[model samples]
Target: MYVLDTNIISELIRPRPNGGVVQWVDTQPLSSLYTTAVTKAEIYYGLHILPMGKQRGDLEQALHQFFSAGLQNRILEFNSTSAMEFAMIASYRRKAGIPISNADAQIAAICSQHGFQLVTRNVSDFAECGIEVMNPFTE
Candidate 1:
């Protein structure tokens, strides 16, 4: 299984004219698509920057589409298991002297804990976390 990063989801949610790569990626089998609860938060927070009009409605509609898609998508909820995983990830980061956003760190930890490959546009940002990374853009 693979977890889709927020930026990739955003692109898929509202494909750009030049987003041929995103469009192509979206056509792939849904069996491989997944996203974390953090990604859900990212998408929701992103919508706040837009006007409270059609754009907000559009974003909500996109979210509905994601929920209806035939993927076994699950929110990577935080629990004792995830907390342990997060602590371990943070320890590693601390030892390595790496700085990462809390949300990014949580995403990396979830992927690592669940043995899921991370599909993202920002490979370099996650490289230090040592999780498997797939850039659909290059595929």
Candidate 2:
């Protein structure tokens, strides 16, 4: 299975017509894709700028369309174990001097723990953390 990084989900929610990554995802088999809690948080963070009156409604509609229909059953939810793994990855990267966002670290840890190929645009960052990455735009 493939775990989608934050940007990939962002593109799906607020689509970029030229986003090759999103297009590539469409070619994958059913149940082959997945999203982590980190991704969901990132998407929600992006949408936080929306007016308060519309935020909830907009987010609900977007999520329903983006996940229910777009990703189907591949939307993986994070559990307590996943959080522990994320903390581990964060510490490892911190000691290694490879600075990265907490969300990215969490996603990477989830992918590592679950043995899922990470679909991301930032390959170098994840590579330094030793997580396998696939750049759909270039692939």
Candidate 3:
């Protein structure tokens, strides 16, 4: 299984998404693809911060449709198990003097809890999290 990071998800909504990412996604089975609630929130927050206009409206519509149609029940939630995993990951990173954002930690927790590899453009951000990561933009 694979959990799509926010950047991977965001690329899909781009006017001209990266060809490498698109091709990589296309080669995977839809059943193997998953996303976290954190990713959903990130996408929504991004759209929310944009000024209201035709561009925003169009992007919103696209995003809504993408979530409603493509993702459906594949969105993972960060529950108790994930929370515990988050605590461990955060503590370890902190002690080692490696900084990770809360959002990235949460996503890493979900991936760790579920034994899923992460698909992201920012592979290095997740390197120390001890979860498998694949950079679709590169491979």
Per-model TM-score, in order, reads 0.84, 0.80, 0.98
- Model 3: residues >4 Å from true position, as ranges? none
lDDT of 3 at 83: 99
- What TM-score does prediction 1 earn? 0.84
Error of 3 at 95 (Å): 0.5
TM-score of 2: 0.80
Query: How well is each residue in 1-139 modelled by candidate 2, as lDDT tens digits?
Result: 8988876776666634446865797789857888876787777676776777765677668876876786776666667777787788888878888778877877887887788999877788785655679988689
Q: Report every candidate's CA lDDT.
A: 0.77, 0.76, 0.94
Q: What's the TM for model 3? A: 0.98
Q: What C-alpha root-mean-square deviation, in Å, does candidate 3 show against the real structure?
A: 0.6
Clashing pairs in 2: none
Q: Residue 9 in candidate 2 has what lDDT?
A: 72
Error of 2 at 62 (Å): 3.0
Tens digits of per-residue lDDT, candidate 1, 50-71, equal: 7889868877887777755633
- Give the alpha carbon lDDT tens digit for every residue of 25-129 in model 3: 999999899999999999999999999999999999999988888888999999999999999999999999998899999999999999999999999899789
lDDT of 1 at 31: 72
Q: What would you estimate as the lDDT of candidate 1? A: 0.77
